[model samples]
Target: MPFVKTTWRNSISFKVLLAYVAGVGLSILLIALGAVALITSRSDILLTTDVAERTHELAGKLMFDVAGHPTGFDDSEGDRVWTFKSLGVEIGYRVLDSQANVVLASTDEAFWSPVAKSPPSDQGRFKFEREGMLMYAATAPVERDGTIWYLQFAVSERLMELLHQGFAWPFMGAGIVLFSLVLLFVFGACAYFTLGYALKPLREVSESAAAISPRSLHSRLDSKTVPSEVAPLVSSFNSALERLEQGYRVQQEFLATAAHELKTPLALIRAQIELMAPDKTRDSLLNDVEHMTRQVQQLLLLAETSEAHNYSFAAVNVGEVVQQAADYLQRMADAARVGIVLTGHTATQTPWQADRSALFTLLKNLLENAIQHAPEGTQVRVQCTADKLTVRDWGSGVEQAQLPHIFTRFWRGAHRRDHGAGLGLTICQEIARAHGWTLVAHRAEPGLAFCLSPPVTDSPSMNSSQESS
Candidate 1:
């Protein structure tokens, strides 16, 4: 029952099917009731008509016998009554005088009830109960020697009930069974096919939507083939996709244009600032200028990385890339008072096919970011393995909740920013993605660790190209 209730609540198709079945079943039940009542009423009317005719016939016979015998049962009449009783005909008869007393009866033991009072003159038939038995009676008036006698004939109520039940019960049972069978056959097929046909448009809409992606934003949902009820939703979704694509294109264009437009002026400003006298103020101004310059460079890199430019892949040694990145950041590491260590190096480390410049940029960003974030006098260890490299630092690690947001562009956590643009990790992520590699950050006990692994390639290939600075 609970399962049925839940299904009815959650499933529209189930509810629809149930509604149809319930309505049809209820209709069949009411129709069967009406049919049974009509049949029973008609049968009772016919039985009453037969009782009236039999009562009159028996009255005539009884009057003729009484006229010959004067006051008692005749031998021929008695024999006829015994024959009917032997046949199991359960018929009772009595003759009443003008005073309503039973003067004569067919039964010797007084099975026939005496008339308690005079019946209404218009009442030719009536029903009554006596002792534990129900009975139906038909009456007629007869003249015998100038005295009026009431002749009464009765039939058993139990017999009448048996006749009605015997006919009505089987007919009703068969009707219900036939209705259930027909309902199952007709309703099952209609529900299955109707629901399938109705949901086909929704299924098509889902498949079409699933096939769309960033590369295929131009695709639109086909409203023509969908149902009228769902076409509005598909139209709205297509409109939303159009707006999103336009907004994305506009953002990409703005980033590219702004970076290109700001590069030369920011560079010239830096060169001019460097020629000034050396002082604390000068140093502060120079630091700010350098920060701005780095931001612009990062912005340009972000724009380039986001585009659909084809990057050249090549065979590059992971150890060589790590060493180069660490060496290049030696000055920055020294400035931060952090030491860079290289370990786990061995011969026969397989060189995988990847973009050399992209790998360098990736390693450089990771190493620099770790060094910048690590405490002074702490070491950033660069560990190399068969197909992966990890840079571990000893500093306050990122909060567990902030880990996911670290890879997003320009996102900063609860850490000090020393002229950091917050794009370093994001850039590394993009480079790794472009080269078909994966970069993941982990919360090392002392600090954070970043791991890089190149995706497996089928063959060894070598090529070289410079990355945009």
Candidate 2:
């Protein structure tokens, strides 16, 4: 589950989808706010229209009577105000003189206090809240008997609020919910199709890249179909592969040519040294020539094994190969006064995919390295199972810190030997790598063991059998 979450977190398509949804959701929220503002403004406009029309009607009715009286008004002539009050509209009204005195008023004194102190010249509409009710008021001037009188009509907003809330709240809430759900669905569908369509070319590029390997470095990416944003990276990768292929070819050629050129003279020198008298100096010279010759031979073998094309992979028996290598190295083991023992083979031959010549060279180097490191009268054991071979020497094992550097070319330990230039184990590791095997070194009970085995991908069944055995 943690791995799944990690993959989801790193997914570009998921991130893109989330970003797209957030952007659209923010836009929808802004639009919904604007819509709410519009609805509220429209409700206020409706309330104001009702107040204005009522103010105009009241002014027409009261203009003549108020002009004649210009004093405290009686209830008999207040026809519209009385009718509106009877109908429970909660409207209020008043008339004022030029000095802002209340000449007439509704029975509800609190309703008219919002506009009672104003002048006749202030003949316009206004709005305010009074006692928790939104009120809209309008004033009109009536010139009668040479006195300016202001007639005002104001109404509570309870009816408007009821009408607005009756429909608006449900509509806005459902609209927001429905819009969000629809937007999420639509955006998710569109993003899936869009990303899939857009990344199709990238998928093609990936598949083509996966087909390329170290053996096929000449293959190039087809940039024509790839997105322009990614073309340069693919081009750079191809250029790097080209450089690596050229460098590797040049190195292999140099090593092979140099080894061949030095072989003839080194052979002649060894022959001449053999014909000389058996003196200490002569023996030393012969040993040096033999070491030089061994180095040249290892160099040529390293070059040959380094090339991927040189491998001829087939199923080879591990037991048979170990016995052959042991037999060939027996004389050297005897000279070193080190006993060579081969054991740990199954009755049924275990077949593993390998190149015959490279496998032999790998075993030869390991056996020789063990023999060289083994103390006199100590035994070097060669053990073979289904897919593995190990060479363990009963000598002083390498220190734990220096074990990692054992396969490096020309690397020697502190307790050094006089013979090798340290290419033997390097060559062995190179061959194992070229054949896609693992060569691991671990400390044994009293010495060190170098184990060569095929990779799990190549020999799963054989490795299982070996482990069980």
Candidate 3:
């Protein structure tokens, strides 16, 4: 069974919208709870205040009645008790002497306590607990016959408790419902606006891309609808497409030129073979055929290098590549009478990640170019460093005026047109670009130096090797 790999997915707008919804919902819920609590607390306070006010008014009325009696109040008049019952509310009051004995009584026993303790303070409201009931009682002291008398009144607290519980659920439910509706509307509106604004640019990008094809490489995305945050990305994509189109055109031209060059040599070799004498000169014709074949192979390799996916890269030992290239070009170098010297070749190896074949071709081209241009007996020095390769030839250096055009395709230097085709330096530059490396040529004090350096890679421990040819 083959193992399947799963990619993690992420969406920025969805996450942001979800977070906003959650925050808004939580805030609404908290506000709803606070509103319900505040209203309920105010209702409770009003209920309590009403009850207190009514009790105080009733006490005042009773005091007025007692004071207005013609005989004034006497113990023998049989203490009067007044009880008022209305709207399921019962209030009771009694008068007592300083001995703490009840002088009057109320028939509403549920609202009055016979054994209720005296108030702690004089002339103020007091609360007392008795018989599993809570009582809000007020005591007023009156002077009669030079003696202090106490008047007390009480109303049961059960009524207030019932009132609070009665109104609680309805108000809480209404608050919750109202807040839920508000939040629902808010979230829906937010989602709509956010989705529309965020997806607008993406939709435009899709439309533009859909209308584009290989033939319409010049078409570009509309910048007006694109958000500022995404504009740079769109512009960069367009630029990259432009570069790809230009590369394609260059590649087409290269193929046409390569085909023409290769066809000429093949035709020449074939003609030479066909005209060979029947017996003796066959070997000489064969040599010419081999030479033509080598040239064709070289041209084919150059063509392949122009392809986008031609090379597979690996860590190559630069020293090994330079040694091989030098060995292959030894005879040509000897014929030119230009001595090749390899220096700074160390046992310590520097390995660079590159296409092995491409690197070999690049080194060979540089070496051959130097040999062809250098004066006789002048040594061409190849030097290697940890990250760079340098090839120097002690010969007639490149003219300053022609240096800029040396790497252009088919560009022949001022004094070296007959030596070979001028595609060597151009091919070397292409290889360097494909590998993300840098190649530079400069005139040294006595000759020319071609330097190549490997690009930096993410892995620090993976050292790069350099070779000069």
Candidate 4:
């Protein structure tokens, strides 16, 4: 089984998306802390205002003068003070004279101070633990007719506790979870969209670059729309393609020019051998010259067929093309004592879409190959359908190992008896591929079968059909 590879995990977009999500998580944490701080500040202000006001009111009722500091306040004001302690409101007060000595305190010593510690000298409200109980305490200066004294108040820490436990904890915990999810989702979507929008130009450049072949060497990737970070790479790749195109053009020109340059000398050689050919040596020399000439022509043809733009596609009559190839090679087949057989109705009825001359070249090469290898007195069968063409010959097929390289240029495989250039099947494959077809070679029990058709996953059956026939 082929491994299906996925690439998103390796992409920059995925990495950037993860980075955005991480930032969002951190932002939520900072926001949570800030919210708690703001709520704590507002809560403290409300507690302090109420505590200070009550302390001031209770101070006005008592004398600030040290000499007039009364410990026995048997009046309505004192009753109100006792009411708070009796009802367990946890509010306590201590009035101090000029020397910061406590002149009066609430009835319950345990509520104000269990230990004999001096009253808190600090002014602003604050929280502290006394005898394992949390308390909010504040001290403020009280004035009466130019005499200054200190009044300290303490309250139970329950209100602040209630604010945290009742609202802050539950709300913050839920808010963090919900806010994180929403932040990740929103930021994730935005990141993906940004990635797509940003990389679209690179995709266009890639697609255009993929289409650039030797035929399209003049084309260049457009760097204007690409991101600055990627533009240099694209420019370098385009420059590399320019150098490659120059080299490739030189190579192709060398093949064509060499093939053309050798033609006249080969022709003259063939003429000289033909003029003297009556003896066995002369005939053998003429045959060798002929074979060399064919190889030169095949080289020339390969140079032409290798370029995809050279093929002009049209609706070619498949049957007619096959008949023409068979007729053209009939003399050669007879010389080898091999018979040519054609099958299928589309041999006369046109149904295939292909390049006509290229198809003719393909069929000519295949038939010549089959004829050259076919055993004497045996038939080289040609089958045609609306969709495919098959050529099979009854001769010893190549080894299974050699079959795979049958179409490789100049690899003649195990066909040592052959004298022609190995470019016959190579040209056929180029033509077939240019027409979007597959030229597959299958080993027949007695010979080899070549199938020219569209690509298929199950090539074994389609490829070996001629052998079964």
Candidate 5:
């Protein structure tokens, strides 16, 4: 089955959207927590302070009764007549001496306790619990004729409970409403900023990628529009596009060269056959025809490497493949008076996952090119490791200036000694690319050395040994 290809639109946009949503959601959550904490703390402090202040004021007013007259502190007439109302609840006051006694009391006995002890002179406020009821009182000292008097104000448990019930819900409700509105605003703001700034660069990248085509593979997204977090990705993509554009140009040139090379051989063969005579030279003519056919076949192989879908991958034995390619080119090497040698130590039975036919074609082309370039009586060495194949010849090596164009189609060296097509190295490079391998040519001791490494695979230990002899 063919490999399933994934596209940028299907992957990148969804990922960006997901990130934006996550950022907005997290911001809203944090804002809601902060708002809840702030609102609850402020409400508690305000309610507590307000209640304390009211209790203090009520205690202050009752102190004047004790100072005005000595008999005013009496339970029948003094500060006992005064009442304090706040937040729809009424409170009453009284005055007492140091002893466990009531100098005066309010209208309701439950509100003012006869047994309630007087507070210390320095005490400002106190709480009393009786009959499962809670009461609040604030005590203040009153200066009389010669002794100190205590003015105490008390409020009923029911009134305090009513005040709490009234204040709690509204404050809580306001806090909740405020928190909700704040969350809404935060979410909206995050969505706007995330989409506007964060996602804007990604959208521009998408548009730039969409504008790129095979014909314009050199086009790249503007680096300024890329976010710092995504800069590496953009840089790597542009680098890949540059490599692809170069590969495409090379393939186009290779196709044109292959077409020209094939036409020459076909034209020669046609001309020779068309002018053939039924004579004793038929055998020699047939040999020439076979030679021409071989050349045409080699040209076809080179053309196939440049084409898009000319190779496939399968399990292949590296040892046997190298030997087969060597055997096929052995006669040609002998004819050129070049010695071809193959040597390495690896498992001959081990198999690799690669395109077998393309591998052979690649090896054959490299060997033929090496033999052709090498001088007479030179040795062309072919070595194979499980992961790499190397071919070296003992002839004048390529010059530094010509090295760059060694793999370029139809690029011939300055010291050319033969009239042959120069698509051999170009075809080898293309096949290496299709298999995701590397093919490099460099100067050896006396001649050129071409090397091809196996493509990198997920399983590193699959074939780590050499296989050449």
Candidate 6:
């Protein structure tokens, strides 16, 4: 699996959650500003309420007659209404009877007979002239028996400033801060669970996409389980897989046909040369033809091994395969005056999941190559363990730089013998890859060693440790 890097800025869920948070913050700021504006716009009403409350307290202190006229002070004159002045600001008030005649005035400023109006039921403010300055005033009705009296109070700019500084701004600021904190908590919690649920389909789609490879071309994305927004993309990818599978099949068929066409003619040419008299020129031509035939055969095997779908996986006995390869290559070993030695358990000892014919071919090629390079009297050692097969030749090992190129198609090292086309290791590598195995070369003291083993990357503990890290 390949690693994919994701940051908050690049993630869709993170960006959406960020947008959510931004919208919430904007709304709170707007509401706070609107609250400030509302208080500013309706300052008159707040002022009126403050004045009316104080007047009521003052009204309770005075004794009134049945006609709504103040008779005398209910309390001592030391606590009179005139002494109750606003902080840093002076305010004035007038007590009027039903006939609009002033019973008392805080200051004798422009004493005039204004229009007779009834006191309002709801709290409100009104404007009137006090000498030349503009004053905000409110009228509240005072009831004595059945008669009504009006208490009107006036306010100054200084009083409004005092209200803002004393209580209004502080209370509103605290309220907005508290509200914002609560909204942040709720929104954070909701975003976590909601985004997790919403993006689950996308995560599933990612896992399904990861499962796709050349071997699983027949499989398709489960578009029905994905989000509607991503369904089209998954469908398109499945369609691309279909096209790739067809193209691959066509290429494989062509290779097969070409190998078949070349093989028959080579066989006929070899038979014709065999019928001719034996000579040096004839022997050289035959050798060249034999090499060409071997290359063609290797090419076919390479094509088949490269195709993932061609191999049938089963419980292949590792020991049996190794012995069979050694036995089949015995004649070649004898011809080269080299011995084949195998040291492992019985045939049915180990069962590995692999393609039987392909495994046999891999072992045969390794053994044959080792025998070819092996010293005349030395032994080609074959070792089979629980999970691996090691083939070593006691010949001059390849140079360090040449090790990496051993499995390359048609690449031959300096120590590699014969005029053979070099597709054996490449085929073995392809077979190992198809079966999820690892084929590696190592220096075996006096010679070279080729190891075929199962891949160790799929362990659950290793996966967990990797993820944790």
**lDDT against the true structure, each candidate:** 0.74, 0.77, 0.68, 0.75, 0.66, 0.75
Model 2 ranges off by over 4 Å: 1-11, 39-163, 189-216, 219-225, 275-277, 346-348, 414-418, 460-469
Query: In terms of lDDT, which candidate is strongest?
Result: 2
Span of ten consecutive residues with least summed lDDT in model 6: 460-469
Q: Which scores higher on lDDT, 1 or 3?
A: 1
Q: What is the TM-score of each candidate against the true structure?
A: 0.57, 0.68, 0.45, 0.71, 0.45, 0.70
State the TM-score for model 5: 0.45
lDDT of 3 at 141: 64
lDDT of 5 at 4: 40
Tens-digit lDDT track of model 6 for 344-418? 736337577778899899999888889878889999998888767789999988888888888999986566557
Residue pairs clashing in model 3 are 350-465
Q: Give the TM-score of candidate 4.
A: 0.71
Q: How many backbone clashes does candidate 3 have?
A: 1
User: What tens digits encode model 1's per-residue C-alpha lDDT throughout 1-469?
Assistant: 0111234467767787777778887877787787677556655565677678867877776634545322533447454656345623466777776666667765543455443465534448876666667667788877777777777778776665665577756777787878777887787788868887897877788787876654357779989888898899999999998998788778978998998999899888888888999999889888998888889889888777655354566567878888888889999899989999998744426786676777788889888888878999899998887767789999898999989988998886555447678798898887766555668999999899998775545222222222221
TM-score (C-alpha, index-matched) for candidate 3? 0.45
lDDT of 5: 0.66
The true-versus-predicted C-alpha distance at residue 250 of model 3, in Å, is 8.5
A best-first ranking of the candidates according to their TM-score comes to: 4, 6, 2, 1, 5, 3
Instruction: Give all candidate RMSDs, comma-separated.
Output: 12.3, 10.7, 17.4, 9.2, 15.7, 7.7
Best by TM-score: 4
The number of clashing residue pairs in each candidate reads: 1, 0, 1, 1, 2, 0
Candidate 2's residue-wise lDDT over 43-134, tens digit each?
66766876788787777666345337544333475454455557444676777777877777764565665554656576587887777777
Displacement of residue 296 (Cα, Å) in model 2 is: 1.1
